[model samples]
Target chain A: MESHYFPIVYLFGNENLAVNLSNILMITVSMAIVFFVCFFMARKISMYPTGAQNALEYLVQFIKNIISSNMDWKQGKHFVMLGLTIILYVFVANMAGIPFELATQDHVVWWKSPTSDPILTISLAIMVIVLTHVYGIKMRGLKEYGKDYFRPAPFLAPFKVLEDLANTLTLGMRLFGNVYAKEVLMLMLVALGTSSLMWGIFAFLPTIIWQAFGVFIGSLQAFIFCMLTMVYMAHKVSADH
Target chain B: MSIFAIPYVRMNDKEANPLIQEFTWLDAIYQLAAFAVLLLLLKKFAFGPIMGMMEKREKHIADQISSAEKNREETEKQLAEQRRLIEEARREAKEIVENSRKMSSQQADEVLASAKQEAERIKETALAEIYQEKTQAINALREQVSTLSVLVASKIIEKEMDEKEQEKLIQETLKEVGEEL
Candidate 1:
């Protein structure tokens, strides 16, 4: 049997019943950090924005541009809050594990990228899918919204349902897979550094180079994740989709 | 052998670590709750007010531009009205000057005519008074000459002839003298 050294769980006790408590703690802390930064930036709004306020306005306009590009502002304006939340949360979560990681007394990792797990990403995907349905139903009456499932023929309803499931699954799994792979590769590089004396000669340079590349990949993943969420939402809300 | 070695697409048996096996429902619930809380906080504090401020600023700029245009229009109207008033005042002043000039000229002509009439009346009165005085003086001189001739005749008759003849001559002479005068 193959064996691995890393513990997915940071710590375990009778008091903790939640699955993978380490990831949960990381997620909670990341959420709190995101909320505090957002609150501080959003504290003072003015007619003429300056400094931090200007940065905040820039973000608002950027999100507005994204929404308007995909669909009309009339229909897309309602999703601004969701877009901001997703982009900020995902970006922060992506880079959270990059700086430095901590280890617990039990030799398990206490800090890592929360998005690397399937549970959190899948939950987010499900929430997005459910919200799209809610918005579709609200915008188009029940009779009209239900008509999309039977388009082109009545026998294709099951396929359309399958399509929805596939879309959600892929959306969640894409993030989880990419982040998990990045973690594995970084771990391999670290292992290469410590495993052999000859390997140590080239290990430090490649590890540093890979870390920089990881930063780029992390940012790209956050952008793609947010972009896909908006696109999926557009399909549900807009008539052209 | 594979397309870019995608993670989920490939069956990597070595990755079947015990810790990465199963997904729990509780974590999903927790994630949902966490996201929901995030959405609520951001919606309340961040997105709503920021967007509102933007709209408000846009409206304020539009209002300022329109009001400035209105003020310019009002100033132009007032300027036109003032120009008209000034033109009217100038016209009135010219009319007043022209009327006064006409009145003064007419008054001078009247004064010249009245002075000419007064001089003619004075000359005519002096001529009438001089004729009247000449007539009175001639009548008085004639009466004195007749009286003197009668006295001389009476003296000569008393010295040379009778009284009746002398009286007849004096009457006839007095008659002739009166006719001639």
Candidate 2:
């Protein structure tokens, strides 16, 4: 068995229902940052956008394009906020731990990306999948939504269930794995540098290079997450499917 | 493996397996709630007003464009109307000029005809006056000749002579009258 300490807090003195304090803190911080930035950008809305307004409009347009590409405007228009929230939250979470990490000597992590944990990402994935189903039923009616599983052939129903499972796992794990690996490599590099004076000098360049690469990966993942989200949404809501 | 074999830090001390093995329900719930709240707040404050403003701007521009087109068409129509009026005025002026020219020429012809008739009347009166004077002169000349002949006959009767004397008396009277007349 392998174990690592975390800053855990039990709810109602139950071990099974414990919460990781670090994850919660990071999640809150990410949410706060996303909310404030969006709020400030949208505060003084103008017809001819300038400065932050331009950037905000550009982000809206970018997300709009993503949605439109996946589905028509009528169905796609509803998901713009959902897409924006996801991208902003994920991107902020991904970039959070890259600048610095906080951990105790005894392996108790106080600060890291919220998305670095599988529980958070998987939870988000589950929520997204559930929302898709809800929208599917709402837009196409429960009967039609159920009929989609048996379409092209009845035997394909089992495979469709499996595909949903696969989609949730991949969506959650993909984000978790990439962010986790990047942080791990960054920590390892820092550890290697601190191991000796000679290694410290050599590890400096690679650490900087890795950090730069991490930025690119974080942004790309954010975009991919948004894109896949709209695609899933299109699958659920659109009539042509 | 050898590189990670540091003295103070054990390989197993790192928190690697906890990521998969540990699952926390509270953390997930907290994150989901936070995300949901953020989405709701952002939708109300950010996306709603921005989208409304954009649509408003688009409609305003469309209205302006349509109004401008309408104004342009109106201007063109007025311009054409003005041009037609000017053309009508010019035609009327030309018609006025043509009537005046015809009137002046007609008056000139009438004046010339009246003057010629007046000149002809004057000439005819002058010729008639000269003929009357000539006729009067001829009558006076005939009367003088008759009186002269009567006087000569009276003088010859007074002489009272035979045929041979009478012829001599008449010859003498003719010589005397020739000398005197």
Candidate 3:
């Protein structure tokens, strides 16, 4: 297997590092792309939306709908920016792997999906959850926020605490797992087909089909991630709900 | 060590599989910073201006609709006033026609009454004149008859009485005769 083509170690360092620099590079590039798209869309906003403005309006309204549905718009409006950032960043990061990766002279994979890295997903998850807690405390005060854990029954406080941990874990792991598996499957298919000429031609159909399915899954996961983040925030920020 | 050594130091070969990477603080910082920057930029350029434009357009439309409604109401009110004026004029015209008809009829009645009175006065003057002429003619005839009677008496008596006695006798005879006629 040519799996060694992906660098597992730092190209220059002797110290123990788990993350590859190339993964970070790809994530940075994906972020840049997301920034560019947003900047461009925002350049010519008008009272009457046309073409790209229409699409931008749709995206903005979509995020607004997700927020307003969960809680009062006054409270939920703050989360729109966070939600947009997550959806756009995750989508772009997820799509990074769709194109064939460029190989370096030292056999390091140049561009792979950033969401495939557990580090990025975990970071995003932690960030989202942390923000919810921060906003919850800010909106409800510390005493009120603390009282939320003992609701329904006082005995369930431990489980409630565990729920927070579990929510973050699942949120991060779900995205990481799906995106990683997609890349692994593609890698396996490519590896399987390229070994033999007849297998390569036959494998083309499955790879092409999986790639199309991957695009759908990628977008769906991004949407789900954003929606869940908003739902969790809404649960914490809302006084009664 | 330089500030850049942190990423490399964090990137270790202990987990040689790049696919399975440990969570590092730097990556979290980067992601958070990247997101923060994105949020700031988008909030400034995209959501702020777009929502404002939408609100502006909404307000403008509302204003236009309200103004149109006001104009329509004004036109309706003006039309009502005009109709009222027209109705008033029509009513006044009818009254004027009725008054003229009443005045002409009164004048005709007055003129007819005056003509009848004038004809009656003229007929009365003519009747008075005819009665005066008849009375004058009768008186003249009476005088002539007296004179003729006297002459006849003188011829028949043939101066039988004296002058004084004759005057007295003539008066008596004239009186008697006048009475008999």
Which number leads on DockQ? Answer: 3
Greater DockQ among 1 and 3 belongs to: 3
**Best-to-worst TM-score order:** 2, 3, 1
Candidate 3 lDDT over A20-39, as tens digits, reads 55666876898789877877
Candidate 3 local accuracy as lDDT?
A: 0.79
Per-residue accuracy of model 2 over B69-174 as CA lDDT, tens digit each:
9999999999999999999999999999999999999989989988888888887887787777766765564456445654666566755656576657556755
In the order shown, the candidates' DockQ scores are 0.19, 0.28, 0.31
Instruction: Give the clashing residue pairs of candidate 2, or none.
Output: none
| Candidate 2: stretches off by over 4 Å | A1-4, B1-16, B97-181
TM-score of each: 0.72, 0.80, 0.79
List the lowest-lDDT window of 10 residues for candidate 3 chain B.
Answer: B3-12
Q: Which stretches of candidate 3 lie over 4 Å from their true place?
A: A4-19, B1-18, B72-76, B79-83, B100-181
Per-residue alpha-carbon lDDT of candidate 1 for residues A1-241, written as tens digits (9 for 90 to 100): 1233233221132223335555667778888888888788878878888776777778878777778878878888888888888877877887787765565554456687888778788888888888888998888768778988888789999999998898899988988887777776777787787789878877989888878877888888877777787887887788766
Question: How displaced is residue A9 in candidate 3, in Å?
Answer: 8.1
Tens-digit lDDT track of model 3 for B1-181: 6434444323335436655544344555666787788778777767667767766888999999999999999999999999999999999999999999999999999899998889888888888887887667655755675566567766777668666876687778767766664
TM-score of chain A of each: 0.87, 0.96, 0.92
For model 1, the DockQ equals 0.19
Per-model C-alpha lDDT, please? 0.75, 0.83, 0.79
How do the residues A1-241 of candidate 2 rate in per-residue lDDT, one tens digit apiece?
2134667755655557667778989999999998888888888988787787778778888999999999999888889899999999999999998998888777777788888998999899888888889999998899999989998799999999998998889999999999989988888898888889999999999999999998988899889988988888888888885
DockQ of 2: 0.28
